[model samples]
Target: MSHPMHDVLGRWKAAFDGHRPGAMAELFTEDALFQGFGPAVVAGQDAVRAYYEAVPDDRRAEVTVLHTYTVGERVAGGFADVTFSDPTGWEAKVHMSLVLRRDDNGWRILQYHVSRVAAGG
Candidate 1:
């Protein structure tokens, strides 16, 4: 059976597919922290938008939810498997932690952390 986490994940993916920064921003809180590809920390909607925009065209990820759990309106925790081809034509796999909140509207991500996994190194 599908979970609430799936709904939130779908919303996040939709934001990415549409490439709508404003829509993506709406999916986060005012003080959300998004740690993307690099080590830099992106906070708030504007910063998140800028960070996402900086992603190379070829650096698109397809995320698959491996697990998820929800705790009240304050938090939702999950791990996802992320696979993508980099701009340099190399495939990469990443493990992502998704943290979101549920308000009157719906779930909004409070934090998103993606960590790259070394391949057969």
Candidate 2:
């Protein structure tokens, strides 16, 4: 059996790898705050959808969960290492952090942030 973190990230990974931007956005809350690989941070599910819509269709991501913690009955947060690659062998890595909240709809991402991974780190 998998934990909530795995359940959520597993779905996220599938959506991202499958190039389903809309499905990716569905993983977040309506008021989610997102800072993807872009320089700008955006809020709301609409913006999250827009941000993911810019991802290259051939690009896929592999996320390794580094840590996760429960803040309360309704909140949880996690850290992960994410590697993105395409068919051409181009790759990028990032340290990702996320906060999720539970509602009647299970867990939804409330905040998502990513930082470029340093060389040799």
Candidate 3:
């Protein structure tokens, strides 16, 4: 059987591939916490939208789930390997973790963190 979270991640990937920051932010909760490759940890949907909007138009991401598990009926956690590429032929790989919660609106991200992985590691 297929995992339900697969569908959720698919929507998230589609948003990024389509370069729609608003659509991407809609996948998170209102008070979601987001920590990208930078030192800053952002919270809230508006901030998340702003963060994603700053991504260069030429950049895109490909995600591969490394692990996933359910914490409970309302919570789930997962990690993914994300490869980001740009028009300049530059590519960077990062490890991403997400905590999702099920609400009336369905599964939404509550926490997200990402760290860059060494190219040759």
lDDT tens digits, residues 32-120, model 3? 99998789999999998998899887788898998889977898878899999998999989999889989999899999999999868
Query: Candidate 1 overall Cα lDDT vs. reference?
Result: 0.79
Best by lDDT: 2
Residue 71 displacement (Å), model 3: 1.7
TM-score of 2: 0.95
Whole-model lDDT values for every prediction? 0.79, 0.90, 0.88
The candidates, ranked best first by lDDT, are: 2, 3, 1
**Over 4 Å off, model 1:** 57-59, 86-90
TM-score of each: 0.83, 0.95, 0.94
RMSD of each: 2.3, 1.1, 1.2
Least accurate 10 contiguous residues by lDDT in model 1: 52-61
Tens digits of per-residue lDDT, candidate 1, 1-121, equal: 6666688778877777656667777887888899978898879989887866765544556889999987875688799988866658778788988788877767788898898888774
Q: How accurate is candidate 3 locally (lDDT)?
A: 0.88
Which regions of candidate 3 deviate over 4 angstroms?
none
